[model samples]
Target: MEVAQVLHMNGGMGESSYASNSLLQRKVLMLTKPIMEVAVTALFSTGATNFPASLAIADLGCSTGPNTLFAVSEIISIMIDLCKATKQEPPEFQVFLNDLPGNDFNTIFSSFLPGFQEKLRGQIKRKDGAWATLPCFFNGVPGSFYGRLFPRESLHLIHSSYSLHWLSQVPRGLEGNKGNIFMARSSPAEVLRAYYEQFQRDFLTFLECRGQELVVGGRMVLTLVGRRSDDPSSKECCYIWELLANALNEMVSEGLIEEEKLDSFNIPMYNPSPKEVQTEVQKQGSFSVDCLELSEVNWSVVDTEFNPNVASKDGGYSMAKSVRAVAEPLLVDHFGEEILDEVFKRYKAQIADGMSKEKAAFVNVNVVILLKKIA
Candidate 1:
C-alpha cells in the first residue's frame, strides 16, 4: 500500500476521528438498543446458558479511546440485568480490547485501568460480600481484524463499529490503464464497482472473523453507513465532502482551476446501502440478521438547492479548503497538519454559521443490525 494511504488513517497521531468521537458509544448504544433487546433476549432465553463465573469479551477495532471498552461495560450492565431476572449467577467478565498494532495501547490502557480497578473491586463486593480484587483483568491485543485475533470460541460477545467500511485499498479497475470502465468522471460504472468489490471482500472477512470468534449462541452488532443512491448527497458534522465538491466546482467555473482535476477528487469515504450490506452479510452464511434499521442521525436538513447546485454554496468547505484539509496533508504529511487543521476549522465555521442562515443538511446514517452466530 502507498504511504499516503497508510497515513490516511493518521496512524499514531492521536487525531483520527476515532479519538475525538466521545459521543460514539452513546450514539451507538442509542441506535443499538432495539437490537440489543433482541440479542440479549435470545442469549438469556436459550436455557439460561450460564457463562463462566467470569465471562470473556472482546471489542474489535477497539480504537485508542474510551469507546473501546464499551462492549465490556455494556455486557456487564446487561449481564447484571439478566442476573436479576433469572436469579442465576452473573458472569464476571474478562475483557479484552483489540485493535491494530499501531493503535494507541498506552492511552487505552491508561484510561481504563483506574476505572477497571474500581469495577473489579465492586464485583468482589457484590459477589463475595467484601472487596479487594483485581477488576476484570483488562488487557490489549493490537492487530488487524483481517485474521484470527483470539483463541477459538474465546469470546462470549464481540463488538465492532464504524471502522469496517475502510477497505484495504482504493478499488482497482478505477484506474484507466487497468482496463475497467471507470474513467476520470463522476458516477462511472467501474468506480462504483471497484468500491463495492472492496467492500464485499472486506465485509465478508469481517463476518467470517465474527463467525469464528463468537460462541455458538453468541451475537454481535454492526453499525455502518447505509445510503440511498438516488439521494447522492450527505452532510455530516462540519465536514461535508459532497457539498464541498460543489464549492470546488464553483471555483472551477470562476476559472480558479481546471475541470480536469474534478475526477481526481472523491469523498475518500464509502457509504454502502442497506440492501448491499444485507447482501454481503447473507453471503457470509454464518450469521442470521435479527434486526435491520437505518437512521439519518448524522443528517441535517439543508437548503433545497444544495443538491442541484453542484457549483455554488454546497454548505461546507470549498474543494480548495478540502485540498488543504485532506489532499495537502496527504502530499506533505508534516507540513500539511496546520494547513488541514486550518481548512477544517474554516469549513466547520462555515457549516455552523451557514446552517444558521439556511436549513443545512443532515448526513447521519446509523445502521444497527443484530446477527446471531448460526454457524
Candidate 2:
C-alpha cells in the first residue's frame, strides 16, 4: 500500500491523537533547538548579500502538532533575529508545512493557525514612528517527501523532524521475515537487505527531490531516529520491535490473532547509522553534508506527564502510548480495530515486564544533519 494512503500521525487532540500524544516528538524538536538556530543563522550569514525579498521555508514531513508550529516559529524567529543583527530588513516569509495527505490538517489549521498568524502579525509591529511590515504566510502541502513535493528552487530553508526514518512503504519479501513485524535481531539476511535497499532508494530520492526544490545554498536541517552502532540488529534500534513482537506472539498463543498475520507484518521504518546517512548524501551529490550529530534520550524521560504510575503497574504504558500514537493506525488497518486495545494491553504488560528487568528504553537517538544545496 502507498504509505501516503495509510500512514499518518493519529489526528486531533483525543487521548490517542498525535496532537495529544506527541510529547516525545516535541522533546526531539526541543533537543535540536541549538542546531536549528545555528543552521538558520549560518544560512543568512553567507547568503544575506543575495537574500531574496521573500524567504521560502518548508518543514517536510511536518506532522500536525504543537511541534510543527514550534519549528516554524523558531525558524522565523531566528531569521528575524539574524536580520536585525545584520542591520538588514526581515524578508516576508512563506512557510509551507508538508506531511502525508492523511494527516490531520484540519486540526492543525483550525487550532494552530490563529495563534501562529497572531504571532506573525505581532512580529510585523514596530516600536519606532515608522510603520514596517514583515509578512509571514502559512500553507499546508500534503504529500510524501520521498518524491517531489515542491517547485524547483522554491525553498530557501527546509526542516524535518522525527519523520525521515519512515520508508515510503514496507519492504518486500517479508514472508521470509518470520515472527516479526519489523526488522529484528532474528530477521533473515534477505529481509535485512530488502530494508537497507529500500531506505537507500527512499532517502536518496528524498535528497534528489529536495535538491531540485531548494535554491542553491539553501539550508536543510533534518532530525530522524538513528542508531549509534554499526550493527543493524543493535539493541538500541531493534529492541522496541522485539518487545512488540513478543506481545504479538503472546496474543497468538492465546489464539487472539492468527499466527500468519503476525508472520506477514513488517514496519516501514529504518533507523540508519550516521555512516549510512552520510553515504547516501555523498552518493546523491546534490547537497554538501555540513553536520551529522547524534543525541540520545530515554523513553522514560520523554514526557513527565506520561511517566509510569509505578503504584498502578503503569511502568511502560507511557512508552506504549507514544508508540501507539504512531503505529496504531497502521496496525488497525492490518489487524482490524477490534483487536487494538487487547493487543496494546498485552504490549503494555510486556513493556512493563521489560522495564522491571532492566530499564527498557528506546535508542531514542536523533540523527541531526545540516545540509546545504550545492550550486
Against the true structure, whose TM-score is highest? 2
Give per-model TM-scores.
0.74, 0.94
lDDT by residue for model 2 (12-71), tens = 888887887777788888888998988888778787326888889999888877777989
RMSD of 2: 2.2
User: Residue by residue across 95-138, what tens digits does model 1's lDDT show?
Assistant: 77776665667766666557756775676577555324433667
Candidate 1 error regions (>4 Å): 1-21, 47-50, 119-135, 176-185, 228-239, 243-269, 298-338, 353-360
Report every candidate's CA lDDT: 0.57, 0.84
- Show the colliding residue pairs in model 2: none
